[model samples]
Target: MAVYTHLGSERLAELIASYDVGELVSAKGIAEGISNSNWLIETTGRDGTGARYVLTMYERRIDVTDLPFFLGLLDHLAAEGCAVPATIHDRDGAACREVEGKAVALIEFLPGVSPSEPSPAQAHSAGRALARVHLAGTRYPHTRQNPLTAENSAGILARFSESRLAGIDPDLPATAARASDIARQMLGGLPESIIHSDLFPDNVLMLGDEVSGLIDFYFAANGAMAYDLAVTHAAWAFDPRGETIDAAVGRALVAGYESVRPLSAEERAALPLLAQAGCLRFVASRTEDWFDTPGDALVRRKDPMEFARRLEFYRDAGQGAFA
Candidate 1:
C-alpha cells in the first residue's frame, strides 16, 4: 500500500481554497488504487452549487523527478483529444503542489465505471486507445530506463533465490530462475518507446461498452511497444481458468491497433517473449508484496500464481497463439 501522510480534511480544504477552487463541501478517502492516497473532493460554489474533483497525495515509492514526465504526457494526450484525466492547475499554474511535505494534485473527475471483464469489442477499442497514446507520446522529451530491465530481474532473482515456501507451492524459486533466463535473453532485442506498462481492465474506465478513459500513470515509462501490447494481451485475454487465451480477442485487439499504426516484423517476433516478461514482472512483484508486506495493510496483494499460470500458458502455446 502507498504510505500516506494523511493530511486531515481541514488542511485539505485550506489547500483547495488556496487554489481558489471555492470551499470544500466534503472530502473522503477513495478506496481504490494501491500507489497513492486518493480522495474525492466536493467543493461548494458561492451560488450553492458544487463540483467534484479527485485529489491525490503522491506516494513516496516513486521518484518525484518522474512526476513532470507523467503529468506532461497526460497534458499532451488530453490536448491531443485523448480521453484522460485533466490535471487541475494551481493558482500559479502549477500542476503539482506541496502540502505537508508531500506532492498533491487535483484532477477533473472522469465519469465512468470500471468494467469487471471487458467484451472482445471493448478490448479492441482499448487496444486502439493504447496505440493512440503510444503514438502521441513517442516524441515526449522525458526518457527513463524501464525499471523492469534484466539487471533488475537478476537482482530480484538473487534476493528471492533462497525462498522455498513463498506461495501456494514451494517451487517459486525455480520458476523465478527460469523467468530470469527468459528475461535476460529477450531484454536486448525489443524496440523501445513510452509505454503504459500497466494497462489492466481496472485501470480502464468504460462508459457502456466503450472505453471512456485510462488512468494510473504510475507505471508509465519508456519501454517496448510490443511489451505494451503483451501487457494488454495478458490483461484482456486471460480468464480465471488459465486455459487458452481467446484468439478472437487477440485478433480484435490487433486489428484495432493496426488501424492506427502497424506492427513491425521484429515486434511481432518479440511479442511472445514480451508477454512472458510481463507475466514474470507481475509475478515477482506480487510475490514480494504478498510475502514481505504486513497483513494489516490496506492494500491486498494479488495471487502470484495467477500470473505464474498465465506465464505457463504462454510458454506452452508458443508464438502460434499470438499469430
Candidate 2:
C-alpha cells in the first residue's frame, strides 16, 4: 500500500473538481518513493475526455519553504525544452495549492520507465542532459547554499560510535576514519556550481535507449558540479557488486558532458576526490537512516561500498580513464 500524510481520495477528488479539470476517474497512490506521497490521477475533461497527471503531496522530509525553488526550477527547465514534468496550474493560475493542509501540485506525466541499471550510452546521455540543465539554470532566480561542511563529516563519524560500528561490522570504525580523512582533505579543493545533487538512476527515465526525462527535483541544489557528476557516475558507471561495469562507459559520459560545457582544469583535477566525498555522504546518510529512521525495512539503502569502489577506481586510474 502507498503511504500518505493526511489527504484522502475524496478530498483530492474535490480539489481536482474545483479546478474544473474534469470528473475524477481514478486516484491511487504510487509506491515507488520513500520520501513523499504520489498519486496517479485520472480525470475526464468537460468534453468527457480522459487525461492523466501526477499529484504530489509534500512529505515531512523536505522543508516546505524549499518547494518554490524546486517548482520554479522545473518550470524554467520545461520552458527551455527539457523533458521534465510540466506543472499544471490551477483555476487561479497557480502551479501549487494548499489542499488538506498539505502543499499539492499537479504535473503533466512524462511517459518512460526508470532505468534500473543504465548502460554506458545512457549514462553519457544523462551527463549531457545534466549539462543542458546547468546551462539553462545559470540565470535562475534562486541560489542554493550548500550545508555540507568538514564539521558535518566529523559529526557523522562521531555519530557512528564504536559499539554501533562493531554491531554492523568490525571494520566500520576504520572505514569511517579513512572516509573522514578523505572528506576533510578534499573539502577545500572541490569545485562548486548549481547541481541536481541526487541523480540516481531511478530519478532518470529512459525511452528505449535515450534519456526521455528527469524527475524528482527534491534534492536539487547549488553545490559542486563535480559532485553531481560523481553522484551520477557512481550511480550509472558501477554495479551493485561494487565493480566498474565498463570503463568506456565512464569515458563516454564525460565526453558527452564536455560536448556541452568544457570542464575546467580545476574541475577535472577534483573529480576523483569529489566522487569520493559523494560516496562518503551517501554512506553516512544510509547508515544514519538505516539505524535512526522508523520503518527501516520500508526504505532500501544502496550499498555504500559500491560508491566507495568507484572512488577507489578514480583515485587509482586518475582522469586518464575518463579522458
Candidate 3:
C-alpha cells in the first residue's frame, strides 16, 4: 500500500461520514506496497468505543470493475472463518465508494503484527492458514483469473528494451526468457482454486506463532493451489535478499500446508517449476517497478534481483527445494 492521492482532513472526514462507522479521528498513510494508496483510519465508534479500519484507494494494477470480486472475497473468506478481514459496507451497503473518481474501500482492521523474520512455528501457522483459505473458497460463487502469471510476466518484460532490463542487471533478460519457456511448459491437470498469489511475510499478521489475519488480497485470484503454496514457500523460506533458502523453514511451511490440505502426487511433482514461476512473477513486477516508480513516490522500491537469485536457486535445486 502507498499514498498517491492525498485526501486532506476535511475530505477524509466527509468520506467517513458517508458510512455509519463513526466520525473520523485520524487517517495515517501507509507506505509499504506499490499498487495503491492506503491509510490506517481511526474513528469514534457509534457505541462510544474506539475502532480502526484500513482504507484502500484503488490506484494502479487494479481495475475498478474488479472491486466486487476483491472486496467480496474478503467478506466471503471472513464469513468462512478464514483469518481475513471483511469489507465494511457503507450505509448504502456499498462495498466501496468513489473518491476523486477512484474506488476506495473500508476494510475491517484486524489485530496482530506482520512478522519480519518469522519463526518455524510461525511459518507452520501461516501455511495452515493458507490451506484453510483454499478449502474455504471452494464454494465461493465468483471466479477471476490470475492476472500475474508467468506468461503475463514475460509479456510485461517484452515491452522493456534489453538495455533497460540490463540496466537492472546484465543477466535479467536471459533470466526472464528462461522463465517464459518454463511458464509455457508448466504442467496442466493441477488443482486450482482462489489463491492469495502474494503471501509475503508483510501480508501476514501473526501473534505468537498463530496467524491472526491475512491482509492485502488485491493479488488474490483463481489459480493453482500448489502454485500458491510455491509462492508462499518462495516468499517465507528465503533470506531478506532472497540469496539463500532456509531448509527448516521450507520444510515447516510445506508440512504446515499439507497438514491442513494434502498435496496430490501431481501437485508434488509440479512444485519445483511452480516455485520457479513464483520467483519469475516477482522478478517481472519488481523489474517494472524498479524502472517505472518515481524517485519520490511514497512507496518503497523492491529489488528485482532478489527474486532473480531465487529463480536461480529453484532451478538448481529442482524438486529437492520442496523435499
Candidate 4:
C-alpha cells in the first residue's frame, strides 16, 4: 500500500510480462498504507480487453514464507462468494513472483472507493460482509497466529525512550502501559476463526452504502472472532482522532453483524476489553512507524495519538461504548 521501493516503467513492464495478465499499460504507485509497496496496474488484458489490478511488492512486516496463507486466503474467500479480490496467478500457476529479492503479486482490482466518513448504513453493510468473511474463512485450512498482540506490542513499546514517547504525546507512555495491563487481564476463550484483524475503513471498498469488496487481508490470521468484531467496531465507531463516538453507527454495525452470526454471551461481555486491545495494538505499531518510517517514503505516517485517544475512550466507556 506504499512505494518504499521504486520500480520504473521498464522494470514494471518486465515484471508484468511474466504473467499472462498482458503487457503493462501503466503502473501508478499507491501511497495510502505503510506495510508493502503497491501499484495500481493497468494491462491490455489476457484476452485483448483491458483490465486493472493491484500489484503489491512485499516490503517488511511480512514473512515471505507466509505469502501462501495471505494469497491463498484471497482465493478461498473469492471462491466462497465473499467480496474479496482474488490473486492473479502467474503463467506458471504461481501466486507470486520474486523480483530481485522481494516478492510481488498481482491482485484482481475491485471497483469502489474507500469511505473517509462512513454512515450507519455503510457500517451495517461492512459489518455483515465481515461476518461473512469470518464464516467463509472457517474452511481455509492454513492457520497463522496474530502477530500484533498486546504482549508482542509491549516489546515494541519497550524500544521507545521516555523522551521519544513524550515527544509524540505526553499521555502516550501511560496509555501504552494501561493498554498492556488491560489486554493481559481480559483473557480470551471465545469463538475462534480466521479473522481479518485489520479491517480499517480504508481496507473496505464501498459503492454508495453497500460494501462491494473487503481488501487488505495482510493482517488476517487465526484468532478470536469476537476480537475481530471488536477491531471493526473500534475502527468504525469513532471520529478520525477517536474523540467522538458515532452512536448510531456503532449500534447499526453490531446489529448487522448479529443478523448474520450472533455473538455468544462471552463474546458480548468481552467486547470492551477486546476493543481496548485493538486500540493499543495500533498505538504501539503507529508509534514505531512514526519514528522509523523514512521521511521521503511514499506513505503517510499515521498519528499514533488517534488510537491512543481510542484506548482511553474504551477504558472509560466500558461495555457502554458498544451498547
Candidate 5:
C-alpha cells in the first residue's frame, strides 16, 4: 500500500471545488499501492447525487504530460464495453488538474471487491474480459510504447550485475539474460493492440465470481495481446512465494482468453516466451525497487527474487510449465 503525498483538508476542498462534483464530505488517504497517493472521496454533489470517487495524485513513475493518453485510453476502453473507471473532468473540460506540482484526477468509484484468493472461474472471466479489452482497443486513437521491453530488461540486469541474488542456486542473472533474448525474438511477431500491460490479479475487481472491473491502466500500452495474457499468468498463477504455479488457474486464464479471441499458432508458441519475459520484467522492476525505494516511501518492497524463482521453474519446465 502507498500514500506518497499528503494533502490538507483545505487543499483537498480546493481541488474538489474545481470539479462539478458536489462539496466534499470526507476525504481519506487510501494506502493500497506503491506508486501514487490515492484518496477515497465522498461528496454530495450539486446534482443531488451521492458521488463516490478516487482521487489519485500522480507521484512517481508516471508522466504528467501522458495523463491524457492514459485517461483517454480508459475512456475509450469503457466506451468499447470494457469495465474501466470513468474519468471525471473538471468544469473546464480537463480530466487532469495540477495539485502542488503533481497531476491529479478524480475517477468514478467502481463498486466491487478485489479477490484475495481468486478461483479458476474468476481467472477465466478475467481472461475473457482481457480479450474484449484488446479487441475494443483496436479503435483507440492514442498509443503509448511499452517501457518494459527486452532492451530495458537487459539494461536492468546490467545495472545490478554486481549484486548477488540471495537464496537462489545457480547464476540467476544469466538465466534472466537468456530469457530476455528469447522473449525479444519470440514476441516480435505476435499481434499488437492496446493491452492492459499490467493486468495482474490486484488490478482486476470481482463482483461475485465474475469480473466487475479492471483497474490501474497506468502501464497500458500498445503491445502484443499475448504478452498481456502472459503478464496475467505470471501474476495470477503464482503462490505467495512466487515459486509454485497454480496450474488450474493458469489453464482457466488461457482457456478463457482463447475462448473469446483465439490465440494464433504463433501466439500460442510465443506464450512461454512472453510469460518468461513478464516474470523477468517484474524481477527487474522489483530489484530496482529493492535498491531505490526511499525509506519514507509508503509502499511495499516486493522481493525481486520471487520472480527469479518463477523464472527458474519455467526454465526447467519450458513451455509445458503453463500446461
Candidate 6:
C-alpha cells in the first residue's frame, strides 16, 4: 500500500529494459511496505528464461546519499554468506539508476512468506540471523550513523506534543522520559557495530521453520549491539496490548543470539533499560508520524500507544522483564 508515486506501463517497461536481467513480462505493486514504492517485477531472458525481481523506487524520508551504504551492505552480507536479498546490477554495471528523478534498484526476489504468527523456533532463528549479521557487518566498509540516540530522543521529546501522548496515557510522556534517562546512561556503554536497526518481524522472510532472508536495510546503522537485540525482542515478543512479552520466545531469541556472539556482562545488565529504549524510540517516531504525515500519503500510521504500553511493562517488571 506504499505506492505513492505511480508509474505508467511504458515507463515501467523502459526502466526494466535498462537492466540485463531480462525483458519485463509483468509488474505488480507490493503493498506491504511503508517506506518506499516497491514492485514485484517479472522478466524473461532472450532464451525464454524467466526470473523474478523487486524494483524499489526510493522515496522521501530516505536519504539519496545513504543508498550506497545500504545497497553495499547487502552485497557485503551476501558475500559473508548471510541470508540476505541480493541486489542485481543493471546492464551498465550499475547497482542503481535514476528514474523519474528517484533512485531505483533491482533486488533479487527472495521467495518465502513472512510469518504472521511466529513460533518460538522462528524467533530463535531471527535472533541467530541478527547476531550473524552483526558479526559480518563488522567487516563492512561503509558505516551509517545512528541518529536515534538517547540524547536526540530526549531533545525530541522536550518539544514533543504532550497532548498527543496524553491521548495514549496521561503519564506516558513521563514514562518515556524516565526510560530515555535510563537508556542515556547505559546504551552508550555497550559494544557498537553496524546493525540492521529495523529487524521487525515483517522484514524477516521465513521458508517454513527457517529464515530465508531479511529485507529492509534503509534503517541499518552503527549502534549498540544490545540495543539492536532489544529492538527485536520488543518487536517479536510483544502482544498487541503490550501487556506481556512471550517468555519462551524472548528466551529463545537471546539464547539463539548468544549461541553466535556471546553477550558481555554490560550488555546483559543493560537489557531492561535497552528494552525500554527500544519501546521509547518506536513511541517517539510513531507519535511524530501519527501527527506529521500528510493525511493523503499512501502510508499506514501505526498506533504509538502500543509502545507506550510496552514502556510501562518494562518499567513495572524491572530487571526480570525480558527474563
Candidate 1 per-residue lDDT, tens place, 1-323, comes to 33356777778888998665779999878876776888888888535577788888887677888888878878878887777887888889998998877888888788888777678788788888888888877867787777875446555656654544354456556567676677667856465668999988899888887779899888898988888998888877877544557777777777777777788888888877778788888777777777787778765657777777777777777787676
lDDT agreement with native, every candidate = 0.77, 0.74, 0.89, 0.89, 0.83, 0.83
- Order of candidate numbers by TM-score, starting with the best: 6, 3, 5, 4, 1, 2
What is the per-residue lDDT of model 3 for residues 1-323, given as tens digits with 9 covering 90 to 100?
44899899999999999888879998899885567898999999877697999899988879888889989999999999999999999999999999998999999988899988988899999999999999988878999988888888888778888788888789777787786697797876788889999999899998888999998888889989999999999999999888889988899999999999999999998898999899999998898888888868866789888898889898999988877
Model 4 regions more than 4 Å off: 158-164, 293-301
Q: What lDDT would candidate 3 get against the real structure? A: 0.89
lDDT for 235 in candidate 6 is 85
Worst 10 residues of 4 by lDDT: 179-188
Question: In candidate 6, which residue pairs get closer than 3 Å at backbone N, Cα or C atoms, i.e. clash?
Answer: 1-31
**Per-residue alpha-carbon lDDT of candidate 6 for residues 70-175, written as tens digits (9 for 90 to 100):** 9998989998999998898888988889998999989988988888778889999999999999999989988888988766666666666667667656876676
lDDT of 2 by residue, 1-323 (tens): 35577566688778887665788888878885656788888999657878888888887787888888888888988998777887888888888888767888887778888778677788778888888887777767797665554346557867777787556556456556767677667655444556787888788888976788889888788876777886677666766766655666677778778888778888888777777677677666666765775545764555545554565666677665465
TM-score of each: 0.90, 0.89, 0.92, 0.91, 0.92, 0.93
Better of 2 and 6 by TM-score: 6
For candidate 2, give the lDDT. 0.74
Give the candidate number with the greatest TM-score: 6
Candidate 5, TM-score vs. the true structure?
Answer: 0.92
Candidate 5 regions with alpha-carbon error over 4 angstroms: 166-171, 177-180, 293-300
**Candidate structures ordered by lDDT, highest first:** 3, 4, 6, 5, 1, 2
**Poorest lDDT segment (10 consecutive residues) of candidate 5:** 161-170
Structure candidate 2, residue pairs in collision: none
Q: For candidate 6, report its TM-score.
A: 0.93
Candidate 6 ranges with C-alpha deviation above 4 Å = 293-300
